[model samples]
Target: MGVKAWLSKPLAAYVHKKQQHWIQHPVEAQKAIFDKIIRKAAGTKFGREHHFDKIKTHADFVKAVPVRDYEGLASYFELVQQGVKDVLWPGKPIYLAKTSGTTSGAKYIPITKDSIPNHINGAKNALLAYIHETGNAGFLDGKLIFLSGSPELEEVGGIPTGRLSGIVNHHVPGYLRTNQMPSYETNCIEDWEVKLDQIIEETIDENMTLISGIPPWVQMYFDKLIRQTGKPIKDIFPNYSLFVYGGVNFEPYRKRLRESMGRCIPSIETFPASEGFFAYQNEQQDKSLLLLLDTGIFYEFIPVDEYFNENPTRLTIGEVQIGVNYALIISSNAGLWAYSIGDTIRFTSIKPYKILVSGRIKHFISAFGEHVIGEEVEQAMDRTMAKYQSAELIEFTVAPYVSQDQGQSYHEWLVEFSRPPHDLGDFEKDLNMQMQQINTYYNDLITGNVLQNLKISVLPMGTFRSYMKSQGKLGGQNKVPRLSNDRQLADGLLAITSS
Candidate 1:
């Protein structure tokens, strides 16, 4: 029997067992997880200050700790960087995941020993869940490649530091290492262009059955692979049946990826931030991802409209409703106490709790009362790209032009296209029309003539590439922010293109 098949029976059973248990007691499952985490970290400085020892119930926990963004929690993190123990978690963190940033600068997020399993097992269970539903375990037998950051870690205040994916790469189970592709040495190369070339050369002929990464980079790798082999991805790896992706909205990339592969593969999406692995597509046939309730993280939601208010109403898992855009707050075993991870998600299903990421909390465009959001931008891009079959949107960012210069305000889009539309003006009009369909506030402004039509600049190719390089976030889970609340990100990209 193959290694994957031999290992599947037990893993599949465990996944099914957990699924059944979670299904029967969805709310209680999270409550139990919350209690366990609170008790585990009760000895820490944050725990002591927040009275974690007394926090027996959800109401008490909420009363003890206040809602905080990254900035609010920075003080504790600063101490932890100096190798402080028992500050947030019970002891020192095993590793710190350094995240890519634009507005906030590079943020170092801790990964405690207690939280390590939550990060690793959460992904393991996701794959097990996929196998359980699809009855496909051969994926485990062949090589699985993770297109991640350089695995060479650095030290910060005596704590190991690197990208989250790179951290995970160092910890891939001993059993899976034999089936994993690309040598450890190659994975440590920092330059993406150099690393991608090596990765293509190494895996071009391997028996790779699964590939996982952020969609854009994965697409880029596949494009390069096809160019090298003179064949589509499916042709190159006939056994490739699973493609795992996340980090950015898959809607816009879905069309492009499907075209690149020349066929569809079963793919799963995940909400994996540096704070915690929050959710994954547990069901094979559904679009909504099941929240990882049993993971070592306590989940909370605040309605997006109320998120910035002085005293916004915060809702526990039991209180969240379907279809409301919510900014997610998490308290984890990793030492984050009631921390806002800056991502927004909406519940797509109430039973068993499945959600769709609406956007980043900081990534929005609301200059002229339009309240445009990430979800709208994704859907609009999807629709427009679908309309013009020949057009390909490589990457893009949008900003509001709240200008009194032309006697009107507008939203300006900077787009990088792989294949330019036959008529750029027509493409822009279609994109604007699609945007109006999804965002009523934006449409109303246009209809009232209070705002001019959306202005689009067809960026010279490599515009986003240059910007990401300049910001030192060239690849590996970094993406261009889709909607900038201000013009900083868009303006930065414009500067890159102009230079």
Candidate 2:
């Protein structure tokens, strides 16, 4: 290890100890840390002018500063896009992590030195927790393949702009740096067709031990890997033990991964974003858990109902209850105060604060004047799968489209089947029936109760992956966005359905 990394190890250890202490402590201790972060954040220029100081209680802060989506950051986002110094943070940002926002088009999120520590700490804590749970740290000692976005940094108005994957790639630890398959700075977008080929050429012979990325990209990578190697991924990388992924639901993608890597490979989920690496899979690996990063951010949970109800209730880390979904609001050192990430999560436990990402708040299907959430769709799909006794789906994405002449509206499912069912018609019928049963509003839309023009259709297998790649979004971190309520959905459907 280099001198800097060696020095960082001790600091990382210290941070890890503090995080462990916070995790084991009562909610009050965690809240105290959050209060201190809020106060410190309020002291910043953006916080001061934005009214962060006027808010005393957590409730007051939630009330005073409305939760902001990506569009809310658009005006100042251009400043960061230009790589201007002191725009978002105190100094020149260390790097810019590029990610696609739901509405604001491509986003260049600033990552400062102050903010990076949180990402690092979050990753460390995730691994440490996994180690404690699995009793295995060496499981990842073999070659680690991270199916990340193109490492190429795009210059926006003369400033470097790229997704979080590129920015994080620029700063990978030198020891691990040599181990990365594709150097992070390469232009992944430019070489779309040969991207996977280049990755395979770089690491096909190496003793790969761990694979990480979004489920779809990982699945695609293995598909190519198998075709090239003339062997299953497990046969080539016998040492592979763990699959680490985040950014989308893995349930639809897990069956294929297990089949490709064999049933023995374990999977872990992480919740990292351009803003900050927020939470990760608990050590036990039972489900994705939210481990508080006390030093880096102060967090608040807005009850999900607050979106529709004017009198929105907010909760601190202490007040969250099990099985309730909440909108994640964060105030971080990176200049985002009470920011709503547009992602929704449900708590499975309060003691350790475990959560399952329900779906993106903005990804709901409401075209027919019916609010259909991702969770509802997910449950419906799960039920349909169980009822039919079909092989697990590799991945699926849904869009709300309307028929032109008929003026009819309906739900379209783009399903990737692991193994095709014998009776395709029966499967489709069962799926549609379960969906209508799960959500009365959805059923009403289909039955012409809500909107007379509703319909349902299924795209051929591999259509979702094709659509994701065509959008320059093929990678380990980005899944075929499960729900698309934007204009892009219309365009995507036109392109894929026509083809």
The model with the greatest lDDT is 1
lDDT of 2 by residue, 302-335 (tens): 7776765665676778788887878888777676
Q: Where does model 1 exceed 4 Å of error?
A: none
lDDT of each: 0.86, 0.69
Candidate 1 per-residue lDDT, tens place, 122-236, comes to: 7887888888887788889888998888888899989999989989887898889998877898888888888899999999989889999999889889889988888988899
Q: What are the per-model C-alpha RMSD values against the true structure?
A: 1.6, 4.0
Please provide TM-scores, in order, for all candidate models, with all chains considered together: 0.96, 0.86
Query: Where does candidate 2 have its weakest 10-residue lDDT segment?
Result: 449-458
lDDT at 445, model 1: 84
What's model 1's lDDT at 7?
A: 82
